[model samples]
Target: MATHLITGAGSGIGAAVARRLHDRGDELVLVARDAGRARELAERFPGAGTLVADLAEPDRVSWALGHQTVPDRIDSLLHVAGVVDLGRIGELTTKTWHHQLNVNLIAPAELTRLFLPQLRAAKGHVVFVNSGAGLTAHAEWGAYAASKHGLKALADSLRNEEHAAGVRVTSVYPGRTASPMQAKVHSQEGKEYDPARWIDPESVATAILTAIDLPRDAEINDLTVRPGR
Candidate 1:
């Protein structure tokens, strides 16, 4: 079974992906900021290991990944951790921008750099859970949009730099999903949250798994999922 490391594995899309992978009998290294949640998931999936770290803090993120006991060669690294802090440029602050950028972009870049050896050895795939915000800027989503755009750039650069080493990078751009983060977005918009208007996290997880399951010779550079209505 291939070993996969997943960040933000406690809830939302991350948790869904972990569940899907577990059901497929793949080994998992689940990382989340909440120790309790991570432990609960580990209990549910007896074969999975857990790592607790807040991706917003770079030093703490480094420490957690540094100390975690993972296999020497990981078959996949799924970057599912992220934050959605919405604000227009006029209302945005340095702290808010930095916090979002650190968690959404910098942390994943660091983790990818740290795991390069194992990824190279296994010729593994790197999946970035990006958003539609990464593609186009919205009126009040300046900070979030900026970070996601940078994340897209990061994935593009990694794909180009690592192709010769047999490392594949895929960016999954999921439109507004029925997630806690999306609920918060709807709250900010002063609108009732409608699950029917959003994509399901499990559906996105299935897309990710499909990308991972592709033949080694072929790679899906990008996959975008959007709500039907």
Candidate 2:
């Protein structure tokens, strides 16, 4: 059974991916923001491991993981945790920018760095669950887009740097998916939230699984998922 260390496993696309992997009998190490969430995920995926590390505060991640039992070789490291708050450039605050950047960009980078040795040892893959914002920026998406754009750059750079080690890197850009985040986005936009109108998290999870499950002779560098409706 391959081992996977995944972030943002509590809900939405992350949860969907985690469920699929768990059902397939893969070993799972889930990262949670706190002890409470760690317990929650542990219960959700019985027998799966949990690590307590807050992605919101990127600086503390290294220290936090240092105190835990990290796996030596994981087949894949999934970066799926993210936070988004929308506001026009003029109204955006430094706090908002920092929070989004820390969670969406810096934390993933840090996690990747911490687990790279394991990834290299296993000839593993790194998957970044980015947003459509990573590809195109729109009004009121300045801060989130900037962070996701940086995430894209991070994945590109990592893929180049790790190719010789047989470590694969992929960035999955998913357009508005039906999740709490989408609901929050709709509320921020003063629009009615409708889950049926968006892409299902399970669909995106399937795409992620497909990328990771490809034969060793090939690699899928990037995937963009859109609403089918």
Candidate 3:
């Protein structure tokens, strides 16, 4: 069984992906801000490990990594942790912008950097759980969009740099999904929350698994999933 490490695995898309991998008998390392939730997930899956961490803080990430007994080779590293704080340019605070970028971009980059040797050794895959905001900017999504755009660039660059090393990197752009984060976005927009109108987290997880299950001779560089209306 391959080992897969997933960030933000306590809830939403991250949790869905963890469940999918676990059901496939893959060993799991689940990282999340909620220690209780992460532990609960670990209990449900035999041989699963959990790391509680706030990805926004650099020191916390370092501590979390130090505490985990990472295998010498990892089959997949999935960056799924993110924050969505919406504000227009006029109302945006420096703290909010920095927080978004730190959690959404910097933390993932550092984690990937740390795991690169393991990934290369196993000829593994790296999946970035990006967003539709990364592809198209909206009025109140400037900060999030900027971070995701940076993520897109990071994924592209990593794919190029790691191709020779047998490491595959994919950027997944998923549309609005039913999650606590989307509920907050709906509240901010003054709109009714409609789960039917949103994409399902499981569907996105399936797309990720599809990328992971591809033949080592091939790779899926980018995947975009949108709700059918």
Identify the leading candidate in terms of TM-score: 2
Cα displacement (angstroms), candidate 3, residue 68, comes to 3.6
Query: Which candidate leads in lDDT?
Result: 2
- After TM-score superposition, the amount by which residue 123's alpha carbon in candidate 1 deviates from its true location, in angstroms, is 0.3
RMSD of 1: 1.3
Instruction: Count clashing residue pairs in model 3.
Output: 0
lDDT of 2 at 221: 96
Model 3, which residues run further than 4 Å from truth? none
lDDT, model 1: 0.90
lDDT of 2 by residue, 1-229 (tens): 9999999998999999999999999999999999999999999999999999999899999999999998877999999989999999999999999999999999999999999999999999999999999999999999999999999999999999999999999999999999989999999999999999999999999999999999989999999999989
Residues 1-229, candidate 3, lDDT per residue (tens digit)? 8999898876789889988888878889877666777668778776888777678885567778787676677899999989999999899999999999999999999889988999999999999999999999989999999999999999999999999999999999999988888998999889999988898899999999999999878899999999976
Candidate 1 regions off by >4 Å?
none
lDDT of each: 0.90, 0.96, 0.89
What's the lDDT for candidate 2?
0.96
Q: Give the TM-score of candidate 1.
A: 0.96
Candidate order by decreasing lDDT: 2, 1, 3
The C-alpha RMSD of each candidate to the native structure, in angstroms, is 1.3, 0.5, 1.4
